[model samples]
Target: MSTLPLLGAAMTVAELEGLQDFILSRDRDLELQDFCELGALDADWKPAAERAKALLQGYKGRLGIHGPFWGFTIASGDVEIQKVVTRRMRQGLEICDFLGATQMVIHSPYLTWDYNNLDNHPGRKAYQNFLDYTHATLDPVIAYAEKIGVTMVVENIMDKDPDIRRILVEDFNTKALAVSIDTGHAHYAHGSTGAPPVDYFVRRAGNSLQHIHLQDADGYADRHWNIGEGNISWAAVFRALGELTSNPRLILELRNKSGILPSVDWLKARGLAE
Candidate 1:
């Protein structure tokens, strides 16, 4: 029999009562990847952990957790800022343990204000500084992840190119340190610049892609619209996945602001579902 094709939804259940809705609606075999909302380094993460555990109790499908997004950076050049970000992310990791989440997604740091002074924005030294700091800081986190039995997957930014992404992957060589290829980010990275086509990233990352943040993108901003709401050629993407030796976990990374379920149904009607 063919391996059961798996699909995941990015939903955070930060309350015990929400499990009923999540389980009733979600597919029994499908994964549920949480988009944790612990944005700051405040001491409000205890409730987040409680909620994740309650919702995931006896959950039949796989579990993955997205680390906090707002005001957190793992690649900061400033040691104090990096320490705060690390503390915040460690809370998310603790939540992963509670929910039995095996995968966690994280973002790299942006440039410091000093970058504004550079003649070439995103200059070699600036990028090198970011990379140097990221590699050093993340080493401890990687060790912590292994100790806790979770793989931390780094995501692609909307402005990065395949070359930079290659460095991101090659610089931190490990199966646990994989890519979270965001579709909208791919369009943004390639649409404005004359970079290689988006698929170049997919093929280059190859088997190292642990998860995908699937969404359609207009020529401009990341619409986060459902499958065909924009111009993204998702059919081609699935076709490419079919050719791969193994497929990464396809996570529908759309906003949950109503209408998303319907759009998912629309994608299902178009044969995007397994």
Candidate 2:
């Protein structure tokens, strides 16, 4: 376990101010939590982007942005809603291009309820509808991402069936599509909704897993606490990661930005991460 597992933090520009030197020394799997609001990428975007670029002038790391995910669904069958979602995605790409980011996080549309209902219909018409609408909504953005060398990693939100996203990425059949796991999200679903455990998510995602949000949470909610503060088996999670060839970016996503270092220390003390 002392193999020096790569780990980094997901934070805003302000939070990164004093921590730049630390990140410079560790794994550079940095994820920027900016421009993730419903309309944050429009007029109120440039100043923050410029500030972040200036702050990270000499930082050479794998950079990613949390794509706009609030108040929109990519699997919407409504033509107008699709247009809105498409605009947000394009806007996110604009920021990614400016910041030289290679990855963007998009939330999955598969709800916990979908497991039972999606296949209940004859011939799985409901599942087919979800796939059809999702493809229609994302095809153009994914094409643009591919052309520009950016990978759009589909993140599990309320997704209980781990295979659904893998199948969606395979169906798309493009280099731009990949999988992302938020540990806290999986843990919450595992305890509350009967979803598989976090370690199972890692195994299920397999080589397609491109990014992970490294947060610890009680099974009660998406607590986003520092690692070692939750009931999740850190050893089990690391063991699962050990079997992966993807080398996914592990970004500590905590609500309290100052918890990043302590979380890393917890993992390091246990010989699970460095």
Candidate 3:
């Protein structure tokens, strides 16, 4: 019997209520998104975490969480800011531990501007500085992740150079770290920023790509539209994914949470996903 690929949705705690059966029917991967807000995590997270457990009862699937990403960058050069980012990310790890999640999505620090200018400084020192700051921020988190058996998948945001995140993950040289690609973000970069196409991002990341945010976009903003709603080449992207040895969690990250299953059906209809 052929094993089906890991496929699922990124949903908040409340969104799981109406979609639990649909999700469990698929019985694959899931990414909890409620813990990404710093204020909410600080105010109180136990209630939501408990509710998530209740809602996810009988769900036997790979679980992950979207870590804190608002109002801060993980690669902030400021020492104080780096400390705060580290703390918030640790809290995210706490949630992962509490929920037994084995994966957490962390946004990449690579920016579009850094692609051409990272070499501007003498001997590529600017890129080295970015790496230094990023490492300082993530090392602690990666250590805890390794201890708890979680893989920190760094997601690409405004990353124009696909090799950058892949190289960073390789530099970490730990199973605790991997790559994540957001199709909409890649498409936006391809059309709007002259970067390579979405499939190229998948191909570049190669086996290091452990998690993927599948969505559609008009090659403009991060629309996060449902699959087939925009212009992404689903067939080509899935073809590239089919070549990967890594069994990545293909999670549909749509703006409208209601579109999760419909998008799955869309992919299924096109024979791109099961």
Candidate 4:
């Protein structure tokens, strides 16, 4: 049985510094999401990175990053768009290097509408086009990440099923590329796009599963509520995760910093963590 450490997603540098004691007290890790956005890698990042490093000094837990996903698609078919996306991702990798983060989470380019529209095309050609574009877009980014020793984990946002995501990771066939499942996104996909249950993602990713965003949703929208505050099936999800040979980092991606401790307590009370 592979057990994963509980992690907290700090949306800002100040919040992470404020909660440093609380996070380390529970032996949890940190996944910094603030610097992973576009335009965030500017001059201000230097000071923020310094502050984060100072705050995390002597912290023994592993670190991860939620890479930039807004305003960019890594699998864009347009060359210019792909270039911009890759540029932002390369910046994200620079931040990862600064923080010594081993794993970086990126949004998967598989959209539900795009996948569904494949039926309108002739005989998997649309699928092939998507694959080709994704490969073209991500290959350079993956190469850079490998050079810096950062594992790029593509997360599911609009994917209605695991097949596309699984295929995307396997197609790369590199150790630097893997899958990340955001529980709230999976729940939303299930309700809005008829996606498989949340457990299906864990089961399908299996060994390739490298990261997780553990949040609860009402199954209608991405609520990002604390665990036990919504309708997600925690027991089923953890059961599936227990079968994985690889231990994926599980981060509590709550909407606010205040929910972090309560969410940790909630998981402990339910035996999801120690």
The true-versus-predicted C-alpha distance at residue 162 of model 2, in Å, is: 1.3
Q: After superposition, how far is residue 42 of candidate 1 from its true place, in Å?
A: 2.0
lDDT of 4 by residue, 20-58 (tens): 887667556678877766668664787887888888888
The RMSD (Cα, Å) of candidate 1 is 4.1
lDDT values for all models: 0.63, 0.87, 0.89, 0.82
> lDDT, candidate 4, residue 96?
89
Clashing pairs in 2: none
Give TM-scores for every candidate, taking all chains together and pairing residue i with residue i: 0.79, 0.96, 0.97, 0.94
Better of 1 and 2 by lDDT: 2
Find the candidate with the highest lDDT and give its number.
3
Q: lDDT ranking from best to worst?
A: 3, 2, 4, 1
Give the per-residue lDDT of model 2 (tens digit) for 145-249: 988789989998898898888888888888888999999999998998999999999999999999999889988799999888899988999999999989899
How many clashing residue pairs appear in each of the predictions shown? 0, 0, 0, 0
Worst 10 residues of 1 by lDDT: 110-119
